[model samples]
Target: MSVEHIQNSVKDVIAYLNENPQDALSNDPPITAVMEDGLRCRATDEDGNTIVTDMPQAIGGGGSAPSPGWLSRAALATCDATRIALHAAQSGVTLDTLEVTTDSVSDDRGLLGLDKSVRAGPLSLRTRVTIGAAGVDQKILREIVDFAVAHSPVADGCRRETPSKVEVRIA
Candidate 1:
């Protein structure tokens, strides 16, 4: 999308939020994942969009779809890109190129419960972003990226601990 469009959209949302501050607090639509077979699962959102996930063959899965860890990295990449775009648009900069790559290091010992001291999550995460805009100063672009990274919701979530409670239902 063009920077002008993004700017106008951001303006509209800011105006809306200003007028209706109560609407600012919200929850994402509930997602449900059902196992198809083995370690394969299909997750559907309220909008009917779905994603499939499976483990690798070494883990006794068919390796048919992206693993959850991969999806997590993808989410981080996309979210960072989005935040950068929004910030650039707000600053009236037209980007010529923008790319974000996310990677993480995970310990199998943690996931497999082989080590009690290891946490069952990524040990380290990194994001690489390539962005440029013709006629815009490199300093401006760096500032935009810095601002976006600072405000990135996904990045914040990944960096901090978010409390979650799970409830089980049996039928």
Candidate 2:
């Protein structure tokens, strides 16, 4: 889609939100996953889009698909890249190239229950966004990058510490 089209769509959403504020507060459709075999699972969205996930053979799975941690990093990078594109489009900046790279460090000992001091998830994650846009002011591009980072949902989610509770049932 064109930049103008994306900008117009965003404007339309803003207008709708202004007119119907309550409609802006809606939940995302649920995503469900079921185990298939040997640590492999299929996750499906409400719209029926599916993704298969599995651990590496080193971790006792078939090495058929990317592990959840790798997926998380990929999700962060893609989400940031998309946000940057949308915000740049809204600002009338034409990007020739956009790339996002992410690095993360996690302690497997914690996941394996061998170390109580280390966390099970990533201890640190960093992302770098590179853009190539000629004729646009560098300051403006920097501001856009900052705005995208601030507005990205995945970035916000990774930065914040949210509580999670699990309920297990035996059938």
Candidate 3:
């Protein structure tokens, strides 16, 4: 979409939210996952959109699909990219190029439960972004990227602690 369209859409949303503060609170649809085969699962959202995940062959999986860990990093990358686009559009900066990459360092021992002291998640995460705009000052572009990172939802969620609970059901 064009930056002008994005800016208009964002402005409309903000105007509506200002008029109706209660509408600002919202909840995303839940996602459900079902195991399909050896270490493979299909997850679907309320809209019927689905994604498949599988572990690598070394972990006794088919290695047919992307692993959950990779999906997490992809989510972060996409989220950061979206936020950067929004901020740039809002700032009236027309970007000529934009790219974001996310990665993490993980320990297999933690995932395999071989080390009790290690957590079952990445030890560290990193993101690299390359952005540019014609006729825009480099300082302004940097500020836009910094602001986007500060407000990115997925990045914030990963950087801070959040509460999660799992329930088991048997049939």
Q: Could you estimate the TM-score for every candidate?
A: 0.97, 0.95, 0.97
Which stretches of model 3 miss by more than 4 angstroms?
none
lDDT of 1 by residue, 1-171 (tens): 788999999999999999999999999899999999999999999899999999999989999999999999999999999999999999999999999999999999999999999988899999999999999999999999999998999999999999999898898
Better of 1 and 2 by lDDT: 1
Best by TM-score: 3
* lDDT tens digits by residue: candidate 2, 1-171: 888998889889889999999998888797888999999988999889998899999888998988888888999999999999999998988899899999898889989989899889899999998987999888989999999999999999999987778889898
Which candidate's lDDT is highest?
A: 3
Q: What does candidate 2 score on TM? A: 0.95
For candidate 3, lDDT tens digit of each residue in 1-171?
Answer: 899999999999999999999998888789999999989999999999999999999999999999999999999999999999999999998899999999999999999999999989999999999999999999999999999999999999999998889799888
Q: Candidate 2: which pairs clash? A: none
Those runs of model 1 whose alpha carbons end farther than 4 Å from true positions after fitting are: none
Q: List the pairs of residues colliding in candidate 1.
A: none
C-alpha lDDT of all candidate models, in order: 0.95, 0.90, 0.96
